[model samples]
Target: MKELRADIERAGLDTLSGRKAPRARVLLIAGRPGSGRSALAGELVRQVADRYPDGVLRARLSEPDGTRVPVGRAARELLDALEAPAPAGAAEDELGEALRTALADRRVLLLLDDAADAEQVDALLPDNPDCLAVVVSAGPLTGIADVRPCTLGGLDTKSAVEVLSRFTGSVRVTVDPRAAERLAEQCQGQPAALVLAGGWLAARPKAAVADLAGQLNADLGQGTVVGRVLRLVHASLPASAARTLRLLSLAPAGLVDPHTAAALAGCSVESARATLDDFVAHGLLHPVGGSSSPQYEVPCCLHPLLSALARDHERPAELQLARARMLERTVRLLQSCRAITETDSLRAREKLLEMPRSLRFPGPRAAADWLRVRRPALLASARLAVADGELDTLARRLMSQLVRAMVAHFGTRAAASDLYDVHGLVLDVAERRNLPRERAAALLNLGDLDARTGRTADALGRYRTALDAGREANDPYATGRAMESVGGAHLELGDYDRAADWFGRALTERLARGEGEDAARLYGRIGAAHTYAGRYGEALRNWRAAVAGHRRNGDVAAQARALSELARVQEYAGRLDESLRTCQEAVEWAGRAEDTRLQAALHLRLADSFQHLGDPASAALHRGTAERMLAEEALEEDSEPEHGANACEIRSSSAEE
Candidate 1:
């Protein structure tokens, strides 16, 4: 005990004697909930907080029972403790500004414990950066942009043992060090749990350490809630606060702000804020964000129990309503992020007309930024909405919107893998619920992603699995799609024979399904494979078949590609004039496809044809146009960088949604 205290004090001296505060002075004591944050706070206050003697005040931003606490009420409580009489009905901003004024020159150590987010921390920051403030929260209080953050994690084995030994005698720990350490590990290194167990052991002098460990292990095995004491405190809250706590159990993000919470609970923001304050007073919540809106979080110590209880008691109707409202908002935000994709297009006015007032985005960039900011919460919401146990069709729609929005606004990497995971989860639930189409759709979507990212082997496996599953389920469309993906993967791996075989199989399936467009695509793949294998005769035959099929189906894009291949074969066959004429027709078809890459390729090929025939003027004109178009394409791609701006826009937009 003596050695540990001495070491802590030495470290405290190191903390206290450091340089003066920066432009933003925030001491964030970050750790997971119930890791002895309060005890550590008190120790730091006693030892080193004296540097600021103006007025050292303590505030509990989160309740011990795992609920959100509000900032206005927290500020009022701080003011009351500081002996500063606040006017009745002071708004949060007024109270926050007042608190700032009170601590401006005082150099007080404001110990805001269990803070939920940066919003609450920002509200209480001293006007004078010289004033030191220790803001403790479960996670990083990052919303406050430039503040210095000191994150704290779990205690080490030695410190945890020493702290517990303070209650259980040192002789007991020394005599059974291994048992003592194992006990600490079983407690998950949570200081509060260790302290409680150690105190109970201290009262029972005859209790063996091994016996206690066995007892705890037994309780865990039996699901008797051995690590659930933190939830009992939550269950003891008043009815209003308890309901608020349960509603927050559905919070997509780990933290919740007042307005969104109000929306979820079908109450006013003031009511939600007041409920948060009441819970904080009762030690049931923690205040999270303060930079923008007030937010709160349930401590991790209380999370497991609270989650289990929620699973048992949450109201289905309320949850569904909240999920639907959140999705509508997400759809609006997604449209905003894809604003550029619709500019000057037919859908521009239609999209604008469909947008909701709540969809106010500063710009397309801001909309994109929101997605990046709220990616985790968006993902969680999708998962939770699917598990609503009702609204299966809406779940499908939500998943589709999620996929479209992710691919459009942030590209494949945004949620492609996560979407695949969620789709799998959804597929399982849907199959159990007897929705075969939903299962097939999810499987086929995931299989598509698996193939696109060069996961040829994995894609092949997924395609085969989905094919068997869909066939068993009598879903011909999915079976056909799966065969196509399997063939695509083989093509990517340069397995010409296997690729052609799979493509033929897919063509048969699509033809049976009467899917002409898809069958044409399969024929084009067969032609391309033959070309890659240098079998010009077989390639020419396949290309003619593909061109005939695509023209019959009026698929200009496919026809263009087939015509280009046929022209190349003719060029190789020494029929220069006929090849040049066919190349011109391919260029015309390429323009009809409206595909920039194909258009560029056709232009380059046409230029080569002209150059081969010694037509310098024609060749020069084509080359210049291609070069100019390529430069413009490169500049456009570089204009919006893939990193900071684009990613931030997506994140920020999602937050708004």
Candidate 2:
């Protein structure tokens, strides 16, 4: 790339090197679809990245279908790259501000690729003068000030021939220099066209450059040099390989793997893989990275041609069926990805056995790695399926599996932002299909994510809607869950009275359904709301009920925690003796529960109570015991051997009755 794109690369580097501007240095790399703008931008970053010192942040500003990526989503992605927190459900302006703030003090390089317009680029530009931004688009950014676009065109004749040599050996090029030059000229010095022509020659060792050049000269079709060359090369493929190439266009984001290709083409994985590699040899696809799974990317320049071919040769129903197969395959893979993590579930293990070996993950780590790498494509698949509109059932299943896979691998909190989007998609499907149960579930999930991200008001609205939907669907679990969530949101908003009211309503639902444990938890929530409202008498009653319920359930840990809360409220209500007795009982329960930390905390509370009562000797003894317990706990933690410096493990478990 450095040799072929020498002039543009040098100019871009020079523009980036000059940091004397008042704001971030902006260099726009504008070109046609296959002019290699992305490749050049990457090379420039590779050369000048160290000079920035902070880091280089890259984002694609458009979807593969030419739709503009929302400014908020783009900002959130950049913020994620910076390892900065982006609040879920945040407005575009707020996220933009957060992004600018994150880049303010850092000397970072921003590579905004495939930008749709000047506004998209402007919104994400860092305010810091020390930063630099390279914007890649198909045309000049008209609104950005003092910025000159480094416009790209086809490669030079010499460079075009060199590109050909890389695919076809130099010996072939050296043998027929004139014919190579003629072929390069016929390609209009376009790198993509040259590569395709070279791949054609490389595939047939007996065919000379003159043979291809003569063929192109005689067969002048009604298109650009690239289009004509592509048609010729595509026409030369075996029937199976040609169909595989056409189906590759259906791949989300133009990213294809053997499994996806096989599903799309109705072939075996090995056959799909061979066809993909063969496409790579023909310059129709580019291998992504040197991964064992072998993913390929359809070049941006050729995507339209392939899609056109598919439309011409494939029936609409056939295309839809192929898409359905791909999505179904994706859903199963996601199911296996998540099920692999449930190592303790015999049902999950049995499900894993039922799946084909190609679909199953080796272990949790490999499953997580696959999920992380395939996340973008997976997300794109959901969006595409939803937009198709006719496949709502498949869309729902895909989103459900995607959400579960993400949560199983990345945790709820870490994946909240993405889950928020998936839940919205679910809501879209549910509303369109008019399915009350699914609508309620989607709303509940969205509300939960909103609450986790501190959007209390938004969460409150979603919860209320979910409650209505749940009741309409006669779903007791969803209704009860929604009521509880509403109470929690009210608590977060400091409306303690309303929170308590909602908790009571939810408690009634739980009790009526004979859900004892959930009813007990609701008692604790009601107590908390009452305590916050300074209703100590009511708080005491509720806390006592919670403690009794936990005792009945034989949950010593819960009982101890409940007793501690009851003691606090008792002390608040001036029943010092009762508080002291409650604290002692809590200590006993904690000990029985084998909760050393809770026991230590209870002992400290006992010490405080004794000190307030003027029993100096008892207070001192309790304090000493508490200190010894904590010290012993710390020693136990220190005695454990350390793993490797970077070694960390995340274990997730489900609760058992």
Q: What is the lDDT of candidate 2?
A: 0.86
Q: Write the per-residue lDDT of candidate 1 for residues 151-187, one digit (tens) a residue.
A: 5556688877887788777888888899888877777
TM-scores for every predicted model = 0.56, 0.92
Residue runs of model 2 more than 4 Å from their true location after superposition: 1-20, 290-292, 615-657
lDDT of 1 at 123: 79
- Predicted candidate 2 versus true structure: per-residue lDDT over 1-657, tens digit per residue: 344334323444335677444557788889987788888888888887897889999898987667789999999988988889688777899999999999989999899989999999999998886788888999989988767788889888899999999988899899999999999999988778888998999999989989999989988878778888988898898888888888888999778999899999999888888888888888888888845456888887788888888998999999999999999999999999999999899999999999999898888988888788777789889999999999999999999999999988887767888898899999999999888899999999988878877889999999999999999999999999999999999999999999999999999999998888889889989999999899998999899899988988888888888898898788778899999999899889989988777787778777778877888789888888888987998988866433332121111111110
How big is the positional error of residue 74 in model 1, measured in Å on the Cα after superposition?
Answer: 33
List the global CA lDDT of all models.
Answer: 0.66, 0.86
Candidate 1 local lDDT, residue 644 = 22
